[model samples]
Target: MSTTTTLEAPNTGTWDGGNEPMKASYGKLMMWFFLLSDAFTFGAFLIVYGLARHKHMPYTGKADDFTFSTEWWPIPEKVYNAFPGLHGMDLPLAFVALMTMILILSSVTMVLAVEAGNRMDKNDVQKWLLWTILFGATFLGCQAWEWTHFITGTEEGMLLADGTRIFGANLTMNQYGPPLFADLFFFITGFHGTHVLSGVVLLIMIFINTVNGVYHKRGHYEMVEKVGLYWHFVDLVWVFVFTFFYLI
Candidate 1:
């Protein structure tokens, strides 16, 4: 007597990890994973910020006695009023709004670059990518100027009850309500600024490679698409930062 044996076929789905899931290449998928993890980091920072703000927010009562006080969370509009070349004009969010617009425009240019890449239009891709880099660099410069203004502070910062004379923002103190405000400001914006700077560098490198016909030689412009994903992520994160840090 002979025993009959049946052999099952091997699984051919993503469980085998043999195919490009979602039609994304390994590099693109990895870029996405990196962005997702980075998003969680930013989210945690923002969540902490929210909790701190809630915990430290000044108490309010009796509208008649309610007065603008340094004890409360610093009003973003009042804090960010100064615009470049407009000394003491009280512009109020103008510079920040401009920065936001600049970043958004750069995101748009990145979209165009990716679109041009899809067509394999090297010249157009180069043009759009260069514009994106310029905008990003300009935004960084603006942020540096803003940081300088913040650090230097006004001629005299708000006086405290103890009369300790808070000058500007540092790790230990802030002219604003709580030191944590400035701490989060520096950490969050500084982190985002670093990302922008890095994106600019990456754009420069990809620009050079695009000119050198690297992508053309490869018969595709997936490099531009990959970097574009990063660029777009940076821009999206800025929107959230702006909402939480500036608008809120």
Candidate 2:
């Protein structure tokens, strides 16, 4: 009867609100909400991409506009080259792969910075944050290289007027994929890169704050912790991107 009553009666609410929080300040709360919204935005984009990839296969723009119509999208392995280093190399997803590693590493460094902040260790914080910044810069450089490779033709063929696809020197109608596939690749990766760039700028701001002793003067460096959360969230987004765009 007590169990039945507990189940049937109006449920009591949490005293602190609908759910317990992570004992964060208002800034951290806002960051969590912001990350949640950003997550939904990226999720919707990937879902749409998946739907398209399943529905319409792309064409191979080769021999001055080789075209193919199909029931699915271009396999990503066919696209995304790096540069002169990987001439005629299959996949050439190495740059993006390296990019993923750097991003994950930067997230680790950011966490360390937060730890240092908690301990009020300014030198430790600066050192780790510098490493984080360097990793971020490296990721950006790799991204730029990828974009450059896409823009210029390698030993393989070049893109169509659509500016979204590429072809090997001998891409057949049945072999090469669609122009739209290229389009989506550039669009999706570019958007994610922009986010990374934004994160870098924010990181710089926090770095400046630390250097200026803003947090130290205030007696706590929770700002570093909050920013670290954002950095980690960006890295998490890349994991899903790599799985869907590369490994899968």
Candidate 3:
């Protein structure tokens, strides 16, 4: 009798389609790529804004008494002093600070939802997702209010070089500092607000799916984790925007 010896295949130390690629699912990897591209877009916008800001002269007037002019950039504290339902009070960065806090709270709730998903606790996931949606909506509402105030401009208004007084901001003219400032503000903040709105819509859909047992039936909650990634990215971008636009 002749015996034949069998040889085992050698390990190549490479992904062979036997598990998730790079230890992450295809969906997750795609989401990351999309976010990376988005980050580049935001970065470009901010970089352009920075270049433009550097080309202008800085405001040297007192925050409370600064007058708008094309000769110099308006102080952020002076321009953003208005607060909702509290006129005649100089509350610089107050509303935006509240908006940032709300966004941060939403991120926290999203974390809770992701954790609940890990535990496969559908009820907890649903509860946390609902809170996250609520917070996102609140942030959007605050943004709308801020935009309205910015468009309406200040009651004092600004006197133009043409011997005419103007109030509020438009795409062409703004009562606050250089026209470029308003242009950048509208573009950047509006872009970020659009992202937040999209996030709120996605969260609502995710909440619905969770309520319908969609993820539960699938035996995994990866969908929640994916959206959580996006939510966190939005919150992080807002922090940068807040710093660049308001604080510094």
Q: Pick the candidate with the highest lDDT.
A: 3
Prediction-by-prediction clash tally: 0, 8, 0
What's the lDDT for candidate 2?
0.74
lDDT of each: 0.88, 0.74, 0.92
Order of the predicted models by TM-score, top scorer first: 3, 1, 2
* Runs off by more than 4 Å, candidate 2: 1-22, 58-72, 81-84, 158-176
Better of 2 and 3 by lDDT: 3
The residue-by-residue lDDT of candidate 3 on 167-195, one tens digit each, is 88988998997899999999999999999
At residue 50, give the lDDT of candidate 3: 93
Q: Per-candidate TM vs. native?
A: 0.89, 0.77, 0.91
lDDT (10s digit) by residue, model 1, range 74-185: 7777678899898978787899999999999999999999999999999999999999999999999999999999887776686878876667788778885678888999
* Colliding pairs, model 2: 56-72, 57-72, 57-73, 58-177, 58-178, 59-177, 59-178, 164-182
TM-score of 1: 0.89
Relative to the true structure, candidate 3 reaches a TM of 0.91
For model 1, the stretches where C-alpha displacement exceeds 4 angstroms are 1-15, 59-70, 162-164
* Model 1, residue 59: C-alpha shift (Å): 6.7
Candidate 3's C-alpha runs over 4 A off are 1-21, 61-65
Question: What is the RMSD, in Å, between candidate 1 and the native fold over all Cα?
Answer: 6.5
- Rank the candidate models, highest lDDT first: 3, 1, 2
